[model samples]
Target chain A: MRPIPPWPRLRRGLEHDYTILTVREDIVADPRTGQEHPRVRIDCGDWVNVIAVTREDQLVLIRQYRFGISAVTLEVPGGIVDPGEDPALAAARELEEETGYVAGRVVALGSVHPNPALQGNRCHSYLALDCVKAHEGHPDAGEDIRVELHPREAIPRLILEGSITHSLVVVAFYLEHLRATAPR
Target chain B: MRPIPPWPRLRRGLEHDYTILTVREDIVADPRTGQEHPRVRIDCGDWVNVIAVTREDQLVLIRQYRFGISAVTLEVPGGIVDPGEDPALAAARELEEETGYVAGRVVALGSVHPNPALQGNRCHSYLALDCVKAHEGHPDAGEDIRVELHPREAIPRLILEGSITHSLVVVAFYLEHLRATAPR
Candidate 1:
């Protein structure tokens, strides 16, 4: 397979900052041709998602309204990873804050770039086993979330029926499935 | 579960057009509180991804350099759906354009918003069965892609090993898995 050579960045500058994400424009020289073009990149901070499995073998999920699509989506616990913060810590913090669930063990599932075509960030997925409700959830003012628990086996069916349509949440479940089936 | 009310859009305007995606800012009023805030939304065109399964039970895949992440990614054949074009047609066109393969039957898997929290578009996944090489591939100027075929059953392992990390492509496969396993 012929690998495409990396483009040489001629110049880059920040275009906009929207708190959650920042946009940047870059002038890069195409390797095949010396010509240059301007490309825009969205810098969404690296994020984390946790599949919190309770001692009863249920998965903790959240249903919240997302403004962009204006739909209340059923999803797993997730949030942005703060700068200089470990992704696992962010996963644990988000899970607790969104569902008031704490896991005894947080194992790494895997990571994926949410949208490598335009977004510059990775989403790390973790499996939080033996989770239990530690306290009442404390969601931020902008976030109005309701938590739900489902048997682990029902996840694939939920995904198929579109009860959970978030792509990253689906990825987290896919990783969990792999981890469960993989020989130790 | 308590469903959060959708925020009211007080005002909206296009902030930036980056050719591939347009960034828009919207002033939204909180449903509970009467406060408004400016939030950014990315308007990317609807996209299509095809899971092309050949007569030999092989999956047609592509490896290409993605500028946003600066990495060559293994992914399913996909591209933006042209304005006024059907997503199924776009899936067929992209499969042939990227891998020179044609399918006897192209079935709709389902659609999911790539990132509904910030992006306003849906990605439709398709199952192209009995695929065969129709002609030589025709990649666009900016696209440097190489095609590869893998045994259909090897897909889950590919995804588990981080070889296929594109979230949407993984979603396509997940949909295909559901389509295969669902009671028809």
Candidate 2:
């Protein structure tokens, strides 16, 4: 494993639809380095993730039926950032639109790949704090999203027992833990 | 948010093409109570995840180009278990196929939702240890997956800086943390 493999993407193709979420395709180069490689490529995507913390120190969460799993799931408020939009702003707008809360400060926690293999999306996570309830909720046409608040410490128990299942929510909590405890 | 809101299925869809991650409609009666709700539903497909650890106390990871994000991703060797395939068996096969390493023992860590909202995939994780190089590497199509070994502690560093962006990888590391620090 000397000089860990360098993944150089030769090129990419990008397009999007103005739907509930936008999907992009990246025509990437293969990384096998010379000598008769397989002549192959891949595509990936990003997702914008938000961690909205309320004034009472509770996390503001949205429970909605995810069309993918067909299960009613609880997740931190977030969505795909439009192609030209800043992810942090997208996080703020999504949190407000989905949960009706406004944050006084928004900090970039980190970014993640929702799935790094066959789709194109990045999950940009943010820590929104000192939130204030701003507007009356207006869920989209097919949205059955309900809001929920939970104690921060109870996260581990929920994860261990199969309560919170959303990928972004779990990662957000873990990132929060890292921020709260990691060495500066 | 007193008493968390009952989860209800608002929409449903099915996806076969990996790119679109499409959603169709499947409505039931009662979402929380399992009663029938006549509505359109989206069926997010199932997903599989694994955490493969080797005997050297290092993790066996695959660094390959994932088309979805158009980036080189470093992840544990894993993929969706074929229909009716035992998760542990799938873990072993994935480990061997992706990294050319075989496991001596496989343990079930847990299962999670990648994104309970848009994905119906259940991310199943496994802990494989006492592994040995079993054969020459064989990854599917244009996969320049270089298998690397990482000391367990390095996981935290990678996650904090956003190198380890895959949700399944983070949860597997968390599962590993629970095992290492939990009462023996």
Candidate 3:
């Protein structure tokens, strides 16, 4: 496959800052036609999510009210990767802070651009093996979360039944599936 | 499994309109603390993506330039679902228009919230079986795409190796995996 040329940006300017994300507008010239077009990009820090599994082969999950949908959702513990923080460490930190589960070993699963078409940041997913409850969770002031544990085998069914509908959460599980099924 | 109450929205106002997405700000009161907090939501039409498979068992995929990431990405054919349009039909239309592959039959795999934490819209995925190339693709004026076909089995490795990194595309494949592995 031939490499596709990138569009040249004619101009760019910050448009809005919404606390969680900042939007920018860019006028880019198409490589093929040299036609200028307006495009919007959302900027934010990278994020991390962990598929934490305990020694009992149960997965630690969380339920929280998401304002966008105005409903509670089942999802893996995750948060933004703070400035100058390693993604792996962020994953471990978020897991413990949100669920109070500490992992014996944390390994990188994979990372993907949440929405490359509109967002510039990536969301890294990690696998935390042999997790154990250390203490009650310490959710942030704006967060109210409930942690739950389910058998590892129930993930696919949960996703299929629409019980777990977050795209990033599902992508994390897909990465875990690849890790488990990969030829060693 | 206790029920988590939704936050009460005290006020909402449109913040920005970025063509593809509109941002709105909401003053929501925490159900637990009754404390008011500002939250932002991105509003957009629902989306659809198709995992098109040919008679020869090859998967139809596309490469396109995404402005947010400022890079060409390998992804499945997809686009926004028009108002009042059926998601399955939208999926098939996207597949045909973006890749010029007409499916013999299309089936709904599943639907997911792209980001329930920040976006209200759902992305519906479909499985388009026995697709055949009918004509050259008709991408929108702003789109420049290259279509490719790969063996269906190559999906896992492509995803594992980071050749295919779109979260929505991965979710579509994960849905297909769930469909294939579900017990009769």
Candidate 4:
């Protein structure tokens, strides 16, 4: 017989000072045995990712400093969604801020949780189309964000060589594929 | 006028260690403006995410405690990849470890640098199909992972509502879409 799914009960867990990442203790009902078992949990800050495509139809990607991952990443332009801000607007703002590029049309690509197991926040990804050069990007204090553009078709080959290996960028590329082929 | 792109630099800046998150830094060149920036980088453990399906063609998913957010999360079956392991092999191991159901086949969906800027390591996602019930799942010492299966069409809807929000999961879904439509 198939085991019944777990039912969570956080009867007790610890909290940490850093708000972005946290861990907890909890329980779940095992599907095979139908019993509760102890487990640890983790959470991370919510973030936003944007797919900024220029007028020539090239993807506008940025290599920005991520405090979590120290390496400057060559990725789609985006940032954290401030409290009470709509994600769509956040996407547009991030695109402009990171690339000095604005969208003539903005499309909601979709949203995804970076790591649901440990983080509570959602990272909504947006696709900005018909983009035009807005201004030169100005990263935050001490930030050194550089921008680049890649032809749409070159992404798959890049993935094979692991050049465009940033997880979010890969997601953005796959989303681009879905948008092209998905039936409305 | 458009800003000229900075030449991509593969250089290191100042480095340090932070106890707060047990992170090591490898300050890299901020490609945006060509400045020396002290970026905080860390080597996070590797991770695995799966795109598993049942005999009925429903997508396999799981929900468990996320200590960071102090909430329950519905997510894809996944785990940390042991050091020196191929991501595709790790993904298959996670599917069976968390779900107890064995798949007839496992394919590399794709890989993503979930958080490249600061964190080290990669997240390998995979597609597992033609599954059958195995023995009870064997979770880690403190894990209480629960498994569930959802219809294929339901995925996109869940994504919008923030239910199915894991970044790796979202990417895996889109990859599945691409494989489904590409010319065979």
Q: Judging by TM-score against the true structure, name the best candidate.
A: 3
Write down the worst ten-residue block by lDDT for model 1 chain B.
B1-10
Provide the global lDDT of candidate 4 against the true structure.
Answer: 0.68
Which prediction has the highest DockQ against the true structure? 3
Off by over 4 Å in 1: none
For each candidate, report its DockQ versus the true two-chain complex. Answer: 0.71, 0.42, 0.86, 0.36
RMSD to truth, every model: 1.6, 5.4, 1.2, 5.6
In candidate 3, which residue ranges exceed 4 Å CA deviation? Answer: none
lDDT of 2 by residue, A1-184 (tens): 5433544544444544424444444444444543322212222235677888888999887777654564567678887687688888988888888888998999998777766664456678899999889885665544556888987776676776677777667777777777777888
Q: What is the Cα-based TM-score of model 2?
A: 0.78
Q: For model 3, how does the per-residue alpha-carbon lDDT over A48-92 read when each residue is reduced to its tens digit?
A: 999999999999999999987889999999999999999999999
Quote the lDDT for A162 in model 1.
81
State the lDDT of candidate 3 residue by residue for B1-184, as single tens digits: 5778889999997678878888888899988899989998999999999999999999999999998788889999999999999999999999988999999999999999999999999999999998999999888898888999999889999999999889999999999999999988
CA lDDT, candidate 4, residue A107: 82
- State residue A70's C-alpha deviation in candidate 3, in Å: 0.6
Q: Estimate each model's TM-score.
A: 0.95, 0.78, 0.97, 0.74
